[model samples]
Target: MGKLPAADWTRREGLRQLTAALGAENLRWVGGAVRDTLLALPVKDIDGATPLLPDAVMERCRQAGIRIVPTGLEHGTLTAVLPEGPVEITSLRRDVATDGRRATVAFATKWQEDASRRDFTINALYAHPETLEISDYFGGLEDLDARRVRFIGDPHERIREDHLRILRYYRFQSRFGADLDEAAEEACAALAHTLKGLSRERIAMELLNLLGLPDPSATIARMRERGVLQVILPEAQACHVEALKRLIAAESTSGIAPNAIRRLAALLPPAPEVADSVAARLRLSRTQRGQLNCAASRVAQDAQNPRALAYTEGMDGAIDRLLLQGAELSALDGWQVPEFPLRGGTIVGRGVIAGPQVAAIMRAVERCWVAEGFPGPDRIEALLEEQLVQVLRDPSA
Candidate 1:
């Protein structure tokens, strides 16, 4: 019986346009939008559920001159791009069959059947587009008020339908639940093996989403205890929990925002090969894999100056290493890595000779420049001369 978002929801000019196009009564706000609104949380995605078929909804929008994309027509979803935002309106559906990765769904004639198909109770609440009345078919409102995350029907059955829900269960539990739903946890734990069937991309995305949460240490530890983490990411063993916890605390103390990739690195064993292997298995992007490799290696922390490490790697990579090492980060404040004023051509022009010797001399001078705390061009010029003399005196030395 909870009231949905009224003022803010009304302000969405896009939703208003969709209301005019789709009829106020035909579409209702559903899923995370309603749940977050009831909890006084910010709603980024405003989706709706309707009993109308996909073609019918598409025709209505076309007649109303609204832009609609059949984002997933086969699954009964159409996206209406409004001035306020893109609202997804999907026909109410019931699961016909599921294979733990995806579901074969059929349009449902009743909201009850659609609500029954949702994974969790908190996500099943629907709000009238005009009246803003909440409809909870499965005690969703009560569970939401109690700060609980529970599966709609049977936990095992729900996990069996989509194995990715196993990770989502922990994520929502951390974000909204006061205590773990015992039945849901046991079901997820028992079906943890099924998670292997999910696409690597989906698993990586879910794990990153969980790591993206502020201080998901306890939930991650719970996942570890339930054997879920080992099933998905065995690289992160029991001992790495404390490592991740330390990194989270260090990030807070250092005034750096939580970063999912760096946090993922914290749970690793500080080996580039391991990070490379894991990143490949998870199908992370090349840049993300490179960053993970850099963080897993101890080369960055071996430098005495943070700026030195920043110069060698990058600001992001240096910060990752500092947070992982739990070291003071004040030295990097208001700091910009200075451009190496002396280019290779500049080195060659300075009588170092154009060859591998020039490159080696350039490297030596660059090291000296960095060691000298990234001095200005004048110092670089002097260092260039100093290295030239040294290299000239001992071409072998």
Candidate 2:
């Protein structure tokens, strides 16, 4: 709501040195810092736009004895690691060519030209790092204050420049603003099919960010409504409006936010192969993949019986998985089940073989213990020994 206070003298000096070394003028702060200053959010990354070429910027940084990295030189980006933090410096550029996955850009001298190529107006604002004077070329400051996210030009054409904007729209909507614009929504729906052309890694990253939002189910439902989710995660397509509404209601009642794996697991229907394929396609990390698999497995097995929960998912595992499911079902008031008390060593000590027989006996003992209200170690050991003796009496019994 208020203009950002003037840049600190120290930062100004650094910028001045950078500009003097490069023989350039009008180096301005841009992107997230400018957007957040208006929103009063804590800014993390400081980005600047300048008319100097990438090579010239690097040369200037080097002359000043500053650490510089050509992170994306071809795309006109340079990273200068100042003592305060890393500042990203990018030359003004227009898209020379694009295939949605990558772009060829040519340097430009006008800030508006650079802003026009950006995805949204709210992000196109800039500020003089030294004086902290704000610049709104496309009414970005007004849009930022209004909390609206509008594409700089034609939505469909912008999306064609990079299909990732489709996901970025939802992310920004969830993070910074409220109320989706009908025209933006309609454009997203019409261009939904183009999302399939995006790289799997890019899609996965966007989906992960979306799911990490505080109230992701609504955004996900919007994606589904627009047929975008169908392209990236068709397995979850069956979870339409009603299912999402129920999930959101349940989440509101539970008062606990579900993590990405739990959220993704809840979105899936009762289909093993579909879950497996989705996990594989998304290239989920091993831990995420395992959690999703466990959640889906618990959901499929109808893990209602205490004995089954103890034997299959164990105590801690059962509690975690059940809590996630409870959040999805809005059944947080259910009674808590005790964990399994028996260990494999308890069965092995009873002269049970160390192979599948030991595992089988331990599982059975644990099941019994869970069903019997999780008896103490003494009782569990006695019950386990009794089962082991009976099993030893007949190998095939």
Candidate 3:
């Protein structure tokens, strides 16, 4: 209800030009930016809503010589490219129909109708671009002030409109809500089975975002208690809440930001094969899948050979495993993983036969080296000779 700290980009020439062309009076800043600002949090993306339809918004941008992207034109959204970043300006809209997964919406001239259709009250708040005076028709400001994230209308009807709202509810609660709303929780639980109707990518994204919060352990535990977690991730039973508490504290003490895959990995069953199944079920990206599987695979090996784990899985994967196991993050400070010193040439130089024998001897020596904490290259020649001699004597050895 008062002036918010303005981002420098809001005053940039490109945004000013776009705002002037669109008629500043017709544009009402909306969504996350307004909610974040009102909560005294840093704003990232800026969004605005207008009564003008998509065509008029596009025409105004064209007239101003601004680049307009019809990012979601059918849904009445256009992104105006600015020097600072893209600001999405969507026309006011109301849901015409929804089937618990997708919505058919129609453009509207009334802000109240637009606000009424949003999933949560906190997300429905809007503000004046210049004055920063909030526009809250749905008690969003009151809910935000109380840190209570609630559905805009009836919880059951809202979830019925979009099953994805169940995940969205948990995501919002992880970040903004002090505690779960019992009605919203019951509605989400009752409709948890409908999560199967949503796409894997959408579910994966919301889960990742929820886990990426500063401390999502409690929120995730609650989701598990409410039977929502099992519906979305049937393979995942418990979140290892105690381990996750230590992991979160380690991240804070070490100034490491929360990582989604690592947090997800912490909650999963501690087996590489189980991680693989979970990744495939959630349709995680290749990199995320690899990191999670690598961490899971190395959890047991980390105790005796953290340096080797770091070498095999990379430093991040190794660290994630270590932290999740309640190890002090200081263990990784100044860690320089020593590389295996022997190569094929080194094996060949020892008079070992060139074919598979050389490869076999090299691998054996590397294993010994890893076991020995990767001693200096100066000592590798001796170790290689010892291994090669044993191989030659046994042949099958």
Estimated TM-score per prediction? 0.96, 0.83, 0.93
Each model's RMSD to truth, in Å? 1.5, 4.1, 2.1
Please give the distance, in angstroms, between residue 151's alpha carbon in candidate 1 and its true position after superposition: 0.5
Candidate with more favorable, higher lDDT: 1 or 2: 1
Q: lDDT per prediction? A: 0.88, 0.73, 0.83
lDDT of 1 by residue, 190-219 (tens): 999999899999999999998999889999
**Candidates 1 and 2 compared by TM-score, better number:** 1
RMSD of 1: 1.5
List ranges where model 3 is wrong by over 4 Å: 1-3, 253-255, 298-301, 391-397
C-alpha lDDT (0 to 100) for residue 29 of candidate 1: 88
- Residue pairs with colliding backbones in model 2 are none
Which ten contiguous residues of candidate 3 have the minimum total lDDT? 1-10
Q: In model 1, how large is the Cα lDDT of residue 207?
A: 93
The numbered model that scores best in lDDT is 1
- The number of residue pairs in model 2 that clash at the backbone is 0
